[model samples]
Target: MKAVVIEQFVSNFEDLKPRDAPLPSSKKSSDIQIKVTHASLTHVDMLYAQGLHQNNKRHVKPPFVLGTEFAGIVISSPSNKFAPGDRVFGGGLGSYAESICVDEGIVRRVPGLWSNAEACAVGVSGAVSYGSLISVARLKRGETVLVLGASGGLGVMAIQIAKAVGAKVIALVGDKEKSRIMKELGADEAVSYRQRNWEEEVRALTDDGEGVHVVYDAIGAIESALKCLRYRGRIVIVGFAARGGKMEEVRANRILLKSAMVHGYRYGEDGRRDPRRTEEVWSGFLNLVEAGGIRPIIFQGNYMGLESIPRAFGDLKMHKVWGRAVLRINEDVEATKEAARL
Candidate 1:
């Protein structure tokens, strides 16, 4: 099998590449064996490669496969809920490979309308966006939301999810093109942080010209995020992708003035701690998918095979990718072709 193994933490994305590796061995009876057809490359993957992710620093070590979200066909299943040849999409580590073994609890059948690539595109980021807005922030219908990093994978999903719940969405992006793209994707309005007075522009889009009801800050713009919040508004800190991989200091005085609530969003860790809550959040997200309120916004790139991982990471870092960048692996393979490759 081919996998992107992080032999040791490197400072550059180019230093990460794929290598021929042994097939994964199942660790438990509940683990489902999947032949990965498509996988989502995320910012966290790059962070892991650079030893900057909290998970990497705390637990995960070198010589590990790097990816978390995937869509594939089941090679075998230990339970009746899934069977051999069933099309499924789910999330776990070691997805940047030809196959992965994940517990049945984390696996889900791919939604009817989505392709393998599409399911791969939304698997984890969708969960994060849905969890942050609907579960953590308690976003309500008729409320207003400002989604930072609106052109990125999570932000794109956040915009659509907020809209599906009847909330007005204001996307805060990096440029004019991203602003246009966000509006086309269901954001009620779009503001570019590149512009001077961008925070004021965001505030002016709100119902009362005070501020938005909720701010989904994925890009470490907490200071500006606070400025764009309404009284008693909710702010969900999803990530610090913009802060050069360092933590940001939030002013307590800002939180005090508005009587605001701030939540540090960590979907994966929260899911591990409370299984029931995970189920509820995932169910709500899938329901929205089934209702056609959400769709995968895949980057326009032919990222095929394991070899493309490095280039994908580079593009993601350069902001060349608009939405989730998917790598197609074994998607169109025949049994003979698979055998021939081996």
Candidate 2:
């Protein structure tokens, strides 16, 4: 198998190179062997490579495979839930390879209308959006929701998912171009955080000049978003994309003034702690995708083959990625007719 192996954490993504590696076999009865066709690139993978991700620092060691989310065809499954040639998409460690073995409990069938690249693109981000908006914030129809970092993968999915539930979405991005893109993606209004009074502008865009009912803050802008929250509103912290990935501080007074509820959402850790509930949420999200309520947005860049991984990582770090960056893994891994129909 050809795999991108991280022998040691490095400051540069260029140090990550492909090597011939041993084929991975299923270690658990519930595991399924898959031939990966495409994989998603993310900041988490960069953090892992730099030895900066909190979870990686605590649990992972050197000499491990480098990626997470993947879409592929199943080669074998012990649980009988999936058969050979079935298309599936899921997230697990060691996905930057030609093949991988993952637990069936974590995998889901790719929707009939989706391509493997699309499946790989949304595998993790879509779940994060669902968990943050639907599970944590309990976003309701007709309520106003504000999304920070509205051009990134999580932000793109958040906008669509919020809109699908009938929420009026206000997307905050870095510039006018991204703002326009978010509006086209179903945001009711879009604002550039570059504007000095963007927070106030967000509040003014809400019904009756009141604040938003929920704030989906993906870039550690909780303090700024606090200025745009309605009374008894909810703020769900998804990530610290700004401040060089360091967390931002929010004043206690602002939260108190709005009578707001603030939550730090980490989908991976939460799912590990409560698998059953995570499974239910994931199942529901898949249902939403199957019904055409949501779709993955691939960044408008050409990323193909294992060698493109470094380029994709560079784009992600530089904030050039508008949506998910997907790397084509095995060109020959085609979808079966039966799997494509379902």
Candidate 3:
């Protein structure tokens, strides 16, 4: 088999390389062998590659295949839920390879409306957006919501998800073009955080100028998020992707005064701890995708195969990708199966 291998913990994304690897076979009765067609190539994959993510670092370590989200055809299944040739998508370890064996519980059939790339495009990020918006915030129809870092994968997904529920969305980005993209993606208003009064602008855009009902914050700008939230508003902290370790303080008094709720969400972690909730969140996200409430914003150049995976990491780190990036591991996958003799 062939894969993108991280041979050691490194400071550079260039350390990732295409290499020969042993094929993975099913070890458990619940596992299924998948012929990988596409895999997610995102900042998180970069983090995993460099051993920056704690759990991925602990489990994957060095000399490991690098990937989580993937879409593929089933080469074999131990259970009746999926048969050979069924198209499935989900998160799994070592999915960067031409093929991988994963527990069937982690994967689900791709909806008929979506393509292989489109199905995996939303994989982990879409679930996180769903958990943050619906599970944590309990966002309601007609409510006003604000999404920070609205140009990234999670933010773009958040914008569409908020709009799907009939909520007016205010998307916050770092530049004018990102703001324009957010508006095109269905955000009712877009604000540039580069502006001096961006928080105030967010407040002004909401109904009656009081504040927004929910804040889906992906950039970890906790201070600014607190400023624009309405009385009794909920703030769902998605991540600290802004690259700063030091964050502005959150005043307990502010929360007390406004009756605010601050939630720190990590969908991946939550799913690990609670399988049922994980199932619910993933299914709900796929249903929404099938219903056309949202779609993956994939780019062709970013879908370069395993050979250019190192470039994928570079593209993400350099901030060159607009939305979630998906890499086609083996578009024709038949060659992969032939090589593996599965």
By TM-score, the best candidate is 1
Model 1 scores worst on lDDT over the 10 consecutive residues at 333-342
TM-score of each: 0.95, 0.94, 0.89
For candidate 3, list the clashing residue pairs, or say none: none
Candidate 3 residue lDDT tens string, 173-247: 777776777788898898888789788888998879999999998877877888999999999998876643334
Candidate ranking (lDDT, best to worst): 1, 2, 3
lDDT of 2 at 141: 97
Residue lDDT tens for model 2, 1-342: 999988888888888888999988889888899999998888878877877776665776787898989999889989679998888999999999999999898888888798888888888788889989999999999999999988988899999999999999999888777878888899989988877988899999998788999999887888888889888999999887665546566689998999999998888888889997788778777778878888788997788888888888988877778878888888466645454656
Off by over 4 Å in 3: 244-254, 334-342
After superposition on all CA atoms, how large is the RMSD of candidate 2? 2.1
Per-candidate clashes come to 0, 0, 0
What's the lDDT for candidate 1?
Answer: 0.87
Q: Per-residue CA lDDT of candidate 1, range 89-118, in tens? A: 888889999999999899888886787888
Off-target runs (Cα >4 Å) in candidate 2 are: 335-342
Scored against the true structure, residue 293 in model 1 reaches a CA lDDT of 92
